[model samples]
Target: MSDLYEKLKRFQQNTPVQKPSPPALVPSSSTSKPLPDQLLKIPGIVRGSQVMEKIQQRDDAKKKFLSTLGVNEVTNPAGKYGYREIKISNRELPITKEDIGGLEIQTISRDASLAVFNANDFLFFDTETTGLAGGTGTTPFLIGIGFFDEDGFRVCQYMMRDYDEEAAVLHDLVKQIGRFPALASYNGKCFDAPILQARFLLNRLRFPITDMPHLDLLFAARRFWKKMLPSCSLSTVESRILGRTREEDISGELIPYVYFDFLRGIRIERMRPVLFHNVEDVVSLAMLAAKICRMVRHPENECRHGWEWFGLGCCLAAAGMWERTFFCLEQAVLEPSLSLEEWIAINKFLSLSYKRLARMKEAVDVWQRMIERGEDVFAMIELAKFHEHTEKKYAEALALTERAILQMRNRQNDVMANGPATVMYEELLHRWNRLLEKRKNP
Candidate 1:
């Protein structure tokens, strides 16, 4: 009877609950691609000297930081695991810091919002790591830096060759990177930067660089290509944006194992695909950044009226382009297929912008509509605050705050509830105390 009961409990535990489908990265809508100018053009990214100056500064910092660690070169010549050295380099490889500084980022967009670069300068970089792990233990044995200047976008990879060359590869990359102002990568913000930071920390080397801005194409791609695809991963974006695909590259999960095989002097063939994969990553970033820049610089020529406008608006706001955000939100609002999520976001942003523009009535109207969408937590919180401060409706604010609190409590998602609910809870106690004080005064 115990055995039977145990088997019955196990069966009950195997039941499936209805999973909440995650929010779509970008809602599907009108099938319009961005304008032709928004297509990636790599040559325009590497055009100027500010870019070069920033690069030099960073390179020196990294070199100074890393030299202290004493791991300066890849000391082995015999390929590991019996693997032979693969001659992946061609045309002497752009070896020096100066040579790489001159490549240009071709501006793909003529949109006004993306006019930061002089229609000419840009940087592109990618990395090949020891493994797929996110921890510091997983080092980038090879770091590739590519950029465009006068000549064009060039792909220069730091080939590990074996344990013997990893140090040399990193050192060379540090020097080369010191020549560009802006840097870019597919998923560099999350993966590349952390990996590089870890490698530098491990070696106790001063990473020679500061004041350089990174445009992670992964996040950018998500905003630009969200309408057409479910995801904005490099593989997906590269296919749609660049008209290129990597069917042949090794899966990222298989990469660390492949490096291990390389260390063991076996599976030299696997390295070829990895190299190709990084090449695609570097090239595609150049293309994608160029495209986004175009849309930013030439918003009037915008072909798609969805996430791109919203994205550019955010970018403009970052650059202190309030008018641009205003314009961007204006364009975003015009899109007929704007989802409930996007509509709320636009309204919130527009409300903020209107306040900045001293248009309180417009901002109030925006929040009122949001209040109507009481199911939307953000909207509810926003409207409650609006009522408290702008309308002087303290009671209305309290009611809205109570509703928000109840909604969060019902879901047991208290930890992430909107700020107003928490504020209201605390403030309620304060107000009660004040009432007691008033009665004593009377």
Candidate 2:
């Protein structure tokens, strides 16, 4: 055994052992194919499944989606595109022209550059898009419009079946919008109309929504309710102004995901809530339009809150409806919730409205209230003018002028007094001289 072991060791020591070669650490760029190219060719690098699986047929998916919606699918004569459309009765929406006076639309839209748009020509429009950050890639899947007809208010929704079907939907929308002279939307001027116009340009279709006047209720709602609501979203406006709350509505942010799922052969049940959300949006558009028109028409009507009265007064003043402005201001002042600043502003407007109507007594009363509250130099000047010129009471005018001069002195060091104090100071001096002259002459 010792001789065998010695021979094996000698043989192993004499034998030459060859070393294995290490792999060549070549750089990735050494390959002719790029990594991204290789990755693209891979079936599914991460998912372990086929990448870019066959997409569902556009027409078939559309049919299935429409079937779930219980809406009719329409194809143009050219058969190049197809869309879905539905018309529901006013029962679905209880708003009528009577609910919003026909004349009131004319008044409310007067300053909105809709001079020619009448109730017959006003179209309430809303859109449901695949994304809120709208651009060329974002598509409006649904366009819902409402207008008054023999059936009261009829809402017609035109929905796209697929990306290719947008042309048909836009064509139908243009035809419907052509009948109306103006479009009323919640935020259409900034959001919906621009998106539709982009879609039309992308499709190489003529965008019929010309320079036509668009009444964006968003601005109006913000002007009136910004002080009252936490946010001026349509939902908040509907709840606060129209007293309508949406229940079981899908979150707006999830709509795009649900629509993409529908395109990928997911069940249509996911899209039903989205469609219902769109429907409510359209119906609420009409109702909100009517509600705003009613508010404009009846500025003197009791408002739900003090801020509403103040907002109405401002609107009336802008429209040159002095009597109505005065009425709204009077109502606003009676509200207990009015802040000191708002109360002063309302009284100032109220005094101006009264003076515009030659109702000097009412104007004087408003100024007296301002003087009692904290003392408004402008109000004091107006009261002094009334006493001196209208009542021919120089003594009373002198007293008011002297009081305003003293108040101006008190506010001289106050930083709040900008140009207003200078103007009031000059007016007070002019009034004092005039009162002295009147006393001497009388």
Candidate lDDT scores, in order, read 0.61, 0.77
- The sequence of per-residue lDDT tens digits that candidate 1 reaches over residues 126-231 is 7778776677877776565665544444666565545544455555556677766566677787888887877677666666544565555676666566765777
Candidate with top lDDT is 2
Weakest ten-residue segment in model 2 by summed lDDT: 47-56
**Candidate 2 at 126: error in angstroms?**
0.8
Error in Å for residue 381 of model 1? 9.1
Error of 1 at 65 (Å): 36
lDDT (tens digit, per residue) of candidate 2 on 313-400: 7776777777777777888888888788878887887888889889888999999999999688778888988888889999998999
Q: Can you give the TM-score per candidate against the true fold?
A: 0.57, 0.73
